[model samples]
Target: MEEVIVTVLSEVRCHLGEGPAYDVASDTAWWFDILERRLFEARLGKGEAQVHPLPVMASALAYVDDARQLIVAEDGLHVRRVADGHLALHVPIEADNAASRSNDARVHPSGTLWTSTMGRKAQTGAGAIYALHGGVLSRLFGNITIPNAICFSPDGGTGYFSDTHENVLHSVPLDPATGLPVGAPSALYRHHGEGGLDGAVTDAEGLIWCARWGAGCVDAYTPAGERVRTVRVPAKQTSCPVFVGADFGRMLVTSAYEDMDEAARAADPQHGRTFLLDLSARGRPEPRIKLGAI
Candidate 1:
């Protein structure tokens, strides 16, 4: 049970902040306020974050290249130009299902993008997980309430996801070449305490760092599902975590005040604020997503 101190990275509060990502080439960090339909960007160690209002609700993103980004949104996968922030539809996800929106996502070492979709109102069994690679999409899991913790191992041979509603994390063997699962997912860990599993990321040592919603902490576990460390966050609803900085020695965590009442919001004053943590763990650089002819 190790603890680390965190400082506010962005002061702008969000109703539902998630999907923090970092682009090493530009030395910038990006995240989303999902409910607000807004995207935020900040240079590592910069003073403040710049806000961009989006036309749709987007939860996650992957750097396609220096000039483009792949955004996982409510409607579909959008290709966003870096120069002017122009966005064009690359592909539709659950576009016909207006009740569903994108959730947590992460990129595999093989240049595959793994994303999830969830019901707008958190409807039971109204979500699923998908993997997109070379412009093709494949549904890996379905009948999920809240698909999250979408991450992969350093070797890309293991994929991890969690249904927050069930408070259980699952792991599946993946085909590293295609980023597709080769076997059924098995339960890796179940939380019986305060918070549920939200989002997670794997480090260079193959350790999983997961945010615990409503618990105000991030927990680290070995690949064997043994909890090893915990990092306390000021915000209760910690949603996601991403490695940032030039050396990827720092972690950026996003929080939310989505379902908080007035009293709860007041009690958790730091809710919805993104934080930067200095820790000993090192992170692997996020791989650029491979895009085929669209």
Candidate 2:
């Protein structure tokens, strides 16, 4: 198989952009700047990106009941109504010490919204993961130091969650009916470094395409947790990646320089920008189902 092509779609300036999701219906890509606390949407070939200021640190996002809006993970959960720009606060996230906040999130096939939190200063095992069910948020797992990428299998029977702090990946058995993991999470794989392995996207074949933060590459892995391929990037700290556009063929990635040194930042101006990758795989993703008040 030929290697995937990674190209700079937008450059190294997003004020710490993290979460990225593609909207096939609108023919645009969406992502958030966590530190900047803003949500953004940009159509391919479009001149400018539309930015919406959000309350608190917005981590990751996905489609909600409405196609025009999304369920956003910030310091809390928020629903951004696309038509009026009205943001409805849904959950109040607890701060460990006014220094901790949420991180990566994923919307499952069964419509459950899952996300995790991280310590403000990259502290170890202080973060946790949670799920938003029927608008009510509940803690599902913990001991996470740097929770990042999250996604479910095509069958919704499994979920992939990564902790960047320890560079450990976990696979939890998912119960689709209640939308929770069934047993103690098991290790999928562990990297040697303390970082890399951030945001992720699942291909149609159930393989994972992960943003190898600090590795300057997007890594693809088989279901058995084996490395398959890598999309080398110019930026070192790749924040996240997701399949975009109709048929989920277009892959989009986000990178950050927030944790880089002065010399590194000076050397790379595109560190915080986003990139587009052309994958051999083609197909749009299934949108999260909207659950009514339970």
Candidate 3:
């Protein structure tokens, strides 16, 4: 396979871009900028991205049990549902640790919410991985530091989760419904370059595609951590990735311009841009869980 090119679909100029998810049924894409405390959406055919600000910072999102609402990660997990022309919170995740907040989350085929959290200042190995089954949370693993990219196989047998701060990726056995691990996590691979990882996607052949933040690239890897190909991103801090569009042919990326200097900003003009990369085939996107509105 060859590395593909990602094009800027829209610029939101979010301070810290992350969390890209597609609403396949609606032909729309959704993402968030944590620092800006906002969620963004765009129709499948639209070239522009629109932002909807929230009172709390949303670090990540996953489909709740309901089809019309989403669970977001920030100070805590919250249920955001559409009602009366607004996305309102229905349930809240009471994070016990103030210094810890979520970075990425994915809904398993069995409908469990899996997310990872890191230190407030980006400190390494200071976070934990969690599984939210039926609205109850459990720490699946510890010493994660910074869990970034994540994706599971079509059959939901194998799973991959990464911590960019450690520059390592680990494969674990996935329990479809509970999102629990049957055994120990096996080490897959680690990045040898400058940037870390952000979000990830699973392709048609069960290949793992990961966004390399700060390195301006996304890579496809085998389950054992063999690099298959790399897609070069135009800007810095390529934070999130999701396969959207009909049949999941379009690769949607979210970038960040957070904590950048004038010189750094000048080097990359596409920061905070929502990009789209066309692929040979679209991957199936994870289904969204709708948490009923309160």
Candidate 4:
């Protein structure tokens, strides 16, 4: 078990730090504090991070281009004006339901978007996964709780996602042309009770790297469910992993200090901070959302 050293990149603490995405064109990265309703961005290697306020609980985002970002907020999917930090409603998805909010999300290689929504109270079966293609939004699954691990395989033929509370990872066959699932999803891996699965990302080698919430580490698994590598960070509540930095040779992990008491925070000063790890494997840029005239 080879270990990688984790370095704290930012000291900002988030109640729930998730949704990490790198913008290659801008040489920056973006993440969100869902509970705080804040968005953060910073240059790859230089400068201070900038914080932007969101009107709603902004869970995840995908790059629309260098100048705009597509976001899944509490209300619905929106197009964010990067220059002015303005968000415009693009598609309405359960906007009237205050109990349900956007959760995990990612874009597909075919310019489509896949995002999930969950109940605010963590109610059972109060969530579902949705896919947006060619200006149409469709639900993929229902009766889900704590949706996470939304990623795709390198070839774009497989889609991976999981419900944190279920402690299982699933893989489904996808339509390459439309980036939608063509068949039923099956279990690829099960975490048992070690820790719940959270956000995940696929590397250039087609491996899925997942953050185990209470395990303080990120594990990589092959499509066949074999554990290949494990990289430990200092934070106990690791939230998500995103490949960033020069040549995509680095992994940026987000953490959370939410619900931690004074003694807990004192023991782990880096609890909610962001961390960077130097990795040998490279990563491809996340797919950009192709908003055709929307």
Higher-ranked by TM-score: 3 or 4: 4
Give me the displacement of residue 166 in model 3, in angstroms. 0.7
Could you give candidate 1's per-residue lDDT for residues 1-294 as a string of tens digits? Answer: 456877888899989999999998888999999999999999875565699999999999999889999999999899999888999999899888989999989999999889999999999999999888888988889999999998898999999999999999999999999899899999999889999899999989999999999999899988888988999999999999998888899999999999899999999999999999999989979999997886
Best by lDDT: 1
- By lDDT: ranked, best first: 1, 4, 2, 3
Error of 3 at 20 (Å): 0.5
Candidate 2 local lDDT, 259-289, one digit each (tens): 6788988887678888887877753475564
* Residue-level lDDT for 40 in candidate 2: 76
The CA lDDT of each predicted structure is 0.92, 0.76, 0.75, 0.89
lDDT of 4 by residue, 18-110 (tens): 998998777798899999999988786686688898888888899887778998888899899889988899998887778998999988889
151 in model 1: Cα distance from truth in Å? Answer: 0.6
- Flag clash pairs in model 4: none
Clashing pairs in 2: 11-273, 12-270, 12-272, 12-273, 247-283, 247-284, 248-283, 248-284
How far out, in Å, is residue 162 in model 1?
A: 0.2
Positional deviation of 206 in candidate 2, in angstroms?
A: 0.4
Quick one: best TM-score, which candidate?
1
Residues 1-294, model 3: lDDT tens digits:
255766777766778888888776677788888887888878867565577878777777765533455646655666565442245544444456777767888877666667777887877678877776675667788787778776787777777888887788888997765557787888889778688877888887888889888988778888778988888788778888888887788788888998889999998988778788877755886865523233
Q: How close is candidate 4 to the true structure, as a TM-score?
A: 0.97
Query: Measured by C-alpha RMSD in angstroms, how accurate is candidate 4?
Result: 1.2
lDDT of 2 at 271: 81
TM, every model: 0.98, 0.91, 0.91, 0.97
| Native-to-model Cα distance after best TM-score fit, residue 50 in candidate 4, in Å | 1.2
